[model samples]
Target: MTDDKSKRDFRDRNRVAGDEEYEVGYFASKFGLSIPQVRELIARHGNDREALEREAKALGVR
Candidate 1:
């Protein structure tokens, strides 16, 4: 469990570029949400790259 958590953590700080556009799933893992939950939240009170970085700073995900 711990390892899975950390593995996702590792994925967050440095986002995967090119092919894999950094997604809500990435943020969800960082924030302990289910993928569907993350997608839903994004759908609710929207934010993309700039907002996502702002959120990450607030949450201190890195």
Candidate 2:
């Protein structure tokens, strides 16, 4: 029997990966904010996905 765990989508959606440039870029685009803004949110919120999202919304996505 072969283990097919590699096919699983193991990404943790509850946390933002600050070190991943693509992840940060995607998050920024999703909120219509700049990469720097998302990065700053990650830094302040410690990558908590919901917190960053709330902060991003409070900042007013444009």
Candidate 3:
């Protein structure tokens, strides 16, 4: 079982871009990353969720 904080954090981290355009601040907060890191992720991997996840994993992020 997950604690409330863990559950909330999971929900927050799992946020999908959906129909909205990716914003650096939004993604950064959602993924627990910095603005510059988010920009670098998007720059290196584009805005695709899968690609971003893969790259983030490779970089040892959540």
Candidate 4:
């Protein structure tokens, strides 16, 4: 369902490879989410860590 452009956008925005805060396991644990869930969050939320955390909290996650 995801297009290549969207995949590129996710990667470019999230920058997870070198950013420890955005790493799958770390982000997932921080938000009490699975890795895939974290990835989906990043994709949907444009990879802003603070914003994602706020959104998660607002959504009653954890």
Candidate 5:
């Protein structure tokens, strides 16, 4: 089955663990933060996927 838009939305917003698609450096650069900082945020807060996109809209990650 195909992933729904909601799932895609969630993944885009999330910075979830177990996601090996992204390297630490990649996340850092995109978020404009240090690698450790990105790691810490993801570790502590985990990810919502959709929330991240919203956050990006607010913070302008794109």
Candidate 6:
């Protein structure tokens, strides 16, 4: 059987999929940022959850 852990872990928690609007919206809401801002952060910083959270806080979003 294929290893589903990678896919499941990613979708459930950890990295945010940049192409997924729902994930973006979730992060945006969590950070109190606009969707576009979250998208921009993802573009610039990639989709690592901890990194994004740190960056968001740095951006004064938290």
Index of the highest-TM-score prediction: 2
Estimate the lDDT of model 5. 0.53
Q: Which stretches of candidate 6 lie over 4 Å from their true place?
A: 1-12
lDDT of 3 by residue, 1-62 (tens): 22355344444444434334455566667667776776787776676766776776666644
Decreasing lDDT order of the candidates: 2, 6, 4, 3, 5, 1
Instruction: Report the C-alpha displacement of residue 58, candidate 2, in angstroms.
Output: 0.3
Instruction: Report clashes for each candidate as comma-separated counts.
Output: 0, 0, 0, 0, 4, 0
Residues 1-62, model 6: lDDT tens digits: 33355564445477888887778898899878999999999999988999999999999734
Global lDDT of each candidate: 0.51, 0.84, 0.61, 0.62, 0.53, 0.83
Q: What is the lDDT of residue 40 in candidate 1?
A: 51
TM-score computed on alpha carbons, candidate 4: 0.54
Comparing 3 and 4 on lDDT, the stronger one: 4
Steric clash pairs (candidate 1) = none
- Candidate 3: lDDT of 3? 33
**Per-prediction TM-score, please?**
0.40, 0.77, 0.49, 0.54, 0.43, 0.75
Selected candidate, larger lDDT, 5 vs 6: 6
Q: Write the per-residue lDDT of candidate 2 for residues 1-62, one digit (tens) a residue.
A: 33355777756778888888888999999889989889888878888888888998989844
Scored by Cα lDDT, where does model 1 land?
0.51
Once fitted onto the true fold, the runs of candidate 4 whose alpha carbons sit more than 4 angstroms away are: 1-22
Which regions of candidate 2 are displaced past 4 Å? 1-11
Cα RMSD, each candidate: 9.7, 5.6, 9.2, 8.1, 7.0, 4.8
- Clash count for candidate 4 is 0
Prediction 3 TM-score vs. true: 0.49
